[model samples]
Target: MTLLATHLVSRLRLKHLRLVDSLARSGNLHRVAVEMHMTQPAATKMLQDAEQLLGAQLFERRPRAMVLTEIGTFVADYAARLLRETDSFAEGLDNLKAGGFGALAIGAIMATTPGLLPRAIAELKQRRPLMTIRLIAATSDILLEALSRNEIALALGRLTEPKDALAFDIEPLATEELWIFTAADHPLASRESVSMAELARLPWVLQPHTSPMRRLIELTLARQGLGSLDNRVETTSIFATLHLVREAGMIACLPKSILVEGVARGTFARLPVALPNQLGPLGIITRKGETPSANAADFIDVLRSMTAPGEELG
Candidate 1:
């Protein structure tokens, strides 16, 4: 058996994962030891034991702070997820006794937040009022990681690249285009048309560097000779971007679907600029080779049914 496989035997315990999680989160042995209510030496020995059990060093000891090895990241990821699920499972028991079904925790990209998911959520609530529904809105990569750790039952996000999509069983939903949106009162709101150069001159709030949306914006900037944007802020929250754009007279390049409601409500306005090569496919990403809980499965069915006939995913 491989070292990872070997470590998955009866040798590993929950405490080992806790140690890994604490170390990853704190990145300082003394601090994490204090958090775990153990001496520094005991924490060090526990880390060493965990490394030995796994046949690999989970962290690299540095002068100032410790850093996780690649394997350590996996350990921490699973550890955090295990804790979340454990708490939810405890809640599940009480819910079950109260005539409630199991929970369906969903992780989704911002693009799905407004148009697709709300309708599906409403339908699920009406049909299964006893089901506990939870949501974690984040970028696609974050959603994928959560799904992988079984932290979430379903994900609605984009598969921007080839490598990341392989981990999930993705069902094609619909293609959504990115748009440059601003508050209706902004100066650019009344422009007949705008170009990348013109929009780049305005204050902006962009997505985090790691997000696919930001990646696309970066690529577009590079092509348009707008490197090193005058970014006012960087965030993963669409709501935050909306707030900034509305109050601060800033611009945002985000999914068209997310901005539609705001535009229809006259809170935000889409710029007339044309973006090349900025289309993203939105889809449903489920755990590979695993079945979700019955309510979650039913929610998935609701999502599929809610999609318009052509946009319906397989």
Candidate 2:
């Protein structure tokens, strides 16, 4: 083996990795030392040792802040990733010793949380009772960001754009149907069928312009020679939309799954108009090249089984 490789494998310490990782965040040796519960001189010694061992300068000492050299940036990034995996491994071992399966963290879009995620979680727990599972409910855009940051192992949502296909291993699970709705007692709610132009005249409660739902609404309207809605309130919250529809007399377009319960309870009524543009297919997304952990793979199996023939997602 090369001398540097030999030195790294034999002499590198966890404290050294932690120092670099902390330095990357704080950019100040004294602050990193305080965070690591060591003296500043000790921190400096660790940094020097790391630089000498790697045969590359890590941080450039500046008056106000230490800046990472190119090699330092790469090493710091790797150290951070390595630290995360180490923590995960320790946690997995602890769980196994406690007679539990390893933990899993997954994110899902708002529409999927109402039914899909809960059902899948229930099924997974039945198979692995002590497995730890965490779910983050948010918009697809937020979920994708979390996925990219390694904050989530899996995501159940739509790809925000075509380029997302290249960044993630996306498995198309199901298609969501978009429907328009209003409060049960609204004037338009009683109509057997409503025209798009007539509905366009009324105020609406809609997701923000960046959301996939809102883009679909714009596309559908544009296809019909109608412009974007001018008389609309924008929000990303489903609860807010429901409130505006019920108390403020504003119309909303949402997934059928999200509205089914409300419609059944006589709280909201589905509009008769059909939209020309449909939201893209919902899918399972993972980092493109990495494999899912055993527990994550099992949970995915549950999701797939639930969506199998004759039992499609609603």
Candidate 3:
């Protein structure tokens, strides 16, 4: 058992796991080496070492493909899980040394920041004042990619469709209804609600065309047979949109969260238009089968509590 343990320790080095994960992703040893910034020979040797320790052939070296053998696939899966857990453990230990309860790295889309995330952060800080929190504001696509790369502990944003590809455990936090918003003094704001036809006639402030929100908005408008409006202002800035809507009287559709406080303060008004809930469900997404940092998990729990039914949003 002692010899076996030593052999296993030598095989499960960080370099070995990195090689295994890369090969599993690319299915090519040369590509894995290139991605890891190592020579192909070194990568080949690492794989050989790992396979020898496990006493199993991990790959079938076909001319056109480096396919995983049954055992190889299993080992790769387990290796990925092991690496994730090891990272979480290391982070937890670092937090202990720093005299903090734990560290949380979180990503949030712009729309979520105004209400959803602030509430979570405030609650977390109040409870775990010593904990370290890192917040990143980005678009959904950027946040998702960062989450996949393990740069952030978790992401808070609209749930992605075709959920299978997300490969995460998602806990729904809130479902913010979409609404058309404009400055309180805007002509359309005077109306209790505006028609979709009327909405399409105004100059619009919108997210960039590449965004999922923009695509969904366009599709919804097209389905209604409404010709596109003058998209004179294209931006990813939620604050800019809010300001534009409040001061410039430009029309923009946004999740209720973004304008909640502004609407309450009479800076903006929600149009009484029957807009479809273009806003998707908001949720916390974490890599599946991986344990999060204690602080991250605790922060998520706090967010869940704050957004629970009957809880008031500040």
Candidate 4:
């Protein structure tokens, strides 16, 4: 290294950096001295020593305040940055020692949003009030995509493709149940039992063909000799499906958890027809080779505890 660079790397110390950073903020020796718990003369001597070592005048002394020379501003700015980074490193180290005190971004399918994920998140927040959490509510495919892009640290959703098994680490959480819902006033609402043939003939509000729920419905119907749905409105939004089921008198096949409020409110009625196949197990998905962040690991622990009691996915 050059002589000047060697002098800086070898001689510059934390105290020198702190004093310059303080000077940049206060612009007065007396205040900087008081803040540093040092006398004014000591502070002045330190600054002079720094200037002499650097072979440059760092500040212009006036009657009232000290103004930074051009080079002093650059040096002080870098010193301030260094101090900030040092403080951040110290805080993160402390948090690591204490456990679970950082930011976490997680994604979940709509099925988990109503009950399962919320309870887990609330419990995590209670344990770590200073933690920052970002929740993304989306479909399983979308959640998987977020995981691939590193947009989320982990996901509570299904694996949409066979290849996902190779790319992500999965821990099965709970199996989701599919239910048929209709408006309370629909013709089939009061029936004790409905034949699959009869139900297949009715208008339906369904998710897109690509969604897992939709695929399950199609597969189940095909097994029952019902070829495919002809009269259906395709939607990915829960609100839109609910509206169509209630206002348009259409049948909707949705996760059991999402219909709790509507069923309680008398806006929706569950049909008597039972699906032969249960949906795939929902699980935690994270990048395969990477270690989870401290906050991610802690949040995952909270989620696992909630699911450990045989709590089915809501």
Please write out the lDDT profile of model 4 over residues 195-278, one tens digit for every residue: 879988889988778778888889889998887889999877888988898899999988889987788898899998888887
Off by over 4 Å in 1: 1-8, 28-78, 81-85, 225-228, 309-314
lDDT of each: 0.81, 0.86, 0.77, 0.85
lDDT per residue for candidate 1 within 1-314, as digits (tens), equals 88767757678777788888888988999998898899999999999998888778888989989998998888888788887788789878788889987677998887777767888899999988888888999988788877878788889887656877567787777777777888999878888888888777777898777788778877888898787677569988777888999999898988777777788899999998767876556777887787778887888888878775335222
Q: Tens digits of per-residue lDDT for model 3 on 83-186?
A: 77677668767976888776677899876777778878988888888777778887776777768767688998754556734577777776666767889888
* The 10-residue segment with the lowest total lDDT in model 3: 305-314
Report RMSD (Å) for each prediction in the order shown: 3.6, 4.2, 6.6, 13.7
Global lDDT of model 2? 0.86
Q: Per-residue lDDT for 1-314 in model 2, tens only?
A: 99868879899888889999989888899999999898999999999999998889999999999999999999998788778778777887898899999888899987787788899999999999988777888778888887886778999988888898788988888887888999999999989988887877889998878678888888878787888799999887888989999999999998888998889999999999888767777888998999999988998898888784333355
Candidate numbers sorted by lDDT from highest down: 2, 4, 1, 3
Model 1 residue 283 CA deviation (Å) reads 1.4
Clashes of 4: 0
The TM-score-based order of candidates, best leading, equals 1, 2, 4, 3
The candidate scoring highest on TM-score is 1
Model 2 TM-score is 0.75
**Per-candidate TM-score against the hidden true structure:** 0.82, 0.75, 0.65, 0.65
